[model samples]
Target: MEESNFTEKDISTVETSILSSVEASTVIIISVTWFDTRLQSIQWFGEMIMLIFITGLSIGENKVADKGKC
Candidate 1:
């Protein structure tokens, strides 16, 4: 088997994709909860947790990018 190499650009692309997914999921969850009051609290909490995780990941990714390691 051959090993594949990933460059900074590749890492950036992956980070962007993950961030986009998180944003999209958060939006969808909030929208659904907004229309369905019964799930509002749960959705809100979930969104908060997800946002924190995403923010942490984003920060880490930025640091890696700053180091030119992606």
Candidate 2:
């Protein structure tokens, strides 16, 4: 099998980035829903975007972790 070049530091950096994105998205979502109740479509769109972003991040995180495991 080919060896992976991903180091512990690299994995940590990726995880940190993903976590930060998740946190930022969550905050934005909350702020939009709480402050602007009239923009229902915008709120739904934002929530959908956040969900997709989080799902992509989760898949990427899993791949990184799997590489580290090798």
Q: Highest TM-score among the candidates is held by which one? A: 1
The segments of candidate 2 whose C-alpha lies over 4 angstroms from its true place after superposition are 1-36
Per candidate, the number of residue pairs that clash is 0, 0
- Angstrom error of the Cα, residue 66, model 1: value is 1.0
Give all candidates' CA lDDT scores. 0.72, 0.74
The best candidate in terms of lDDT = 2
In model 1, the worst 10-residue window by lDDT is: 6-15
Model 1 stretches with alpha carbons more than 4 Å out: 1-20, 23-38
RMSD, every candidate, angstroms:
7.0, 9.6
Residue 34, candidate 2: how far off, in angstroms? 7.5
User: Model 2, 1-70: lDDT tens per residue?
Assistant: 9989976644566567678777877777677688863547877687678678778878998898899999
RMSD of 2: 9.6
TM-score for all predictions? 0.50, 0.48
**Candidate 1 colliding pairs:** none
